[model samples]
Target: MTKFADIKGFVFDLDGVITDTSILHGTAWHQLADSLGVTWTKELGDGLKGISRMDSLEMILKAGHKENDYTQAQKEELAAQKNTNYVAEVDKMTPANILPGMKAFLDDLRAKGYQLSLASASKNAPRVLGKLGLTDYFPKIVDPASLKHGKPDPEIYTKGAELLNLDPAQCIGLEDAAAGVQAINGAGETSLGIGDATELGAADMVFADTSAVTLANIAKHLD
Candidate 1:
């Protein structure tokens, strides 16, 4: 089995993996949809996971059958408005909001001399990290604004590896979204899915949730 000892760096997805801000994002989306008189559902919220804000807005628009109704500027405005709501929710976050075992796991990785980076589609990654008191754990944050494409594109994960000065194969990527798992796999790295196995079949291994993921379990995947 591959051991955690073999992994030189760790690349993490922010929202669902490191924290539970997915609900806040979903709530913002619902508010936006409600304002537009569009019926938003939990199924649609699932689609927004690991995707960019503009893309999520586009999906909402498409779902509402109003995709072409808005100009590019209008779409940008709508995305910004939703971000305002999401940011407000984020501002209320505390370190306690971080997933169980996450802080300790990060500490363990740091003590083992592994570099860490965050590769998230959220433009507010830094803000969220700051809110959760996790900004210090990740030295390298792959900015969403720097990427031309989002999750499922491999660009973010690849960039994360680059920032950590490690090869993709030498890094372990953790995510709670299928698109993120696909992106990690596409980048030729090992993927540890942090959610339901059925939703993350592309991952090399799956954990039921962040609380279930342990350093020992990560090491087992290194093989």
Candidate 2:
């Protein structure tokens, strides 16, 4: 068994991991770019990975050649509006898109008595989770306001470990973003990378996506 404090507790990232909202985010950025007359593409939007909504706006605006024009509050408003648009677009996502294996894995962990928490950079994370009806799965959610720093900086992961009352070494972090993977490692927990290999490189081990993630794989790390 894993020796990490509350070896049963799990910290999961929201965007690319638990929900398929990244695509929505990409579409929103693309829409923003179009309105701003900027060139937007998947590659251009890729850098938004594991970032806050406000930061994403700043980045997108920078790409639009108006970086200095958007003030802090304006950025916040745009980010919020972008979130609104993104959510409306994603309202179509059903149980069909919450990733094929995530529910089963979470249920299995719950059966084993593990505490589950959500760590996400999105300020709109609560709404996202609420929309998906996944609010109950994570009683402990560490949102952007919960910490002074975001992913790749590790404050979120560190806060999750603290909230779970577990040693950093014993906790495990799951993320699909390169920045989040770095945050997990920075927080001193075993990082479980999902999706891209670059993100997984920061992890002690990796899964291609939620479908590839399994309780068995988690057990391997704990062992």
Best by lDDT: 1
Sliding window of 10 residues with minimal summed lDDT for model 1: 1-10
Q: Clashing residue pairs, candidate 2? A: 4-170
Alpha-carbon runs more than 4 Å astray in model 1: 1-3, 37-52, 58-72
Rate residue 49 of model 1 by lDDT.
70
Candidate 2 stretches greater than 4 Å from native: 1-6, 50-80
Task: Give the per-residue lDDT digits (tens) of candidate 2, residues 1-223.
Answer: 3454446567899877887787887887777778777788766789996566777787788777889886788777777778777877777666666777898888888887887788887667777777776778888888677577656898999888788887777678998877888898898888888887763776777887788788787766656
Deviation in angstroms for 73 in model 1? 3.5
Give lDDT for model 2: 0.78
TM-score of each: 0.86, 0.82
CA-lDDT, candidates in order: 0.87, 0.78
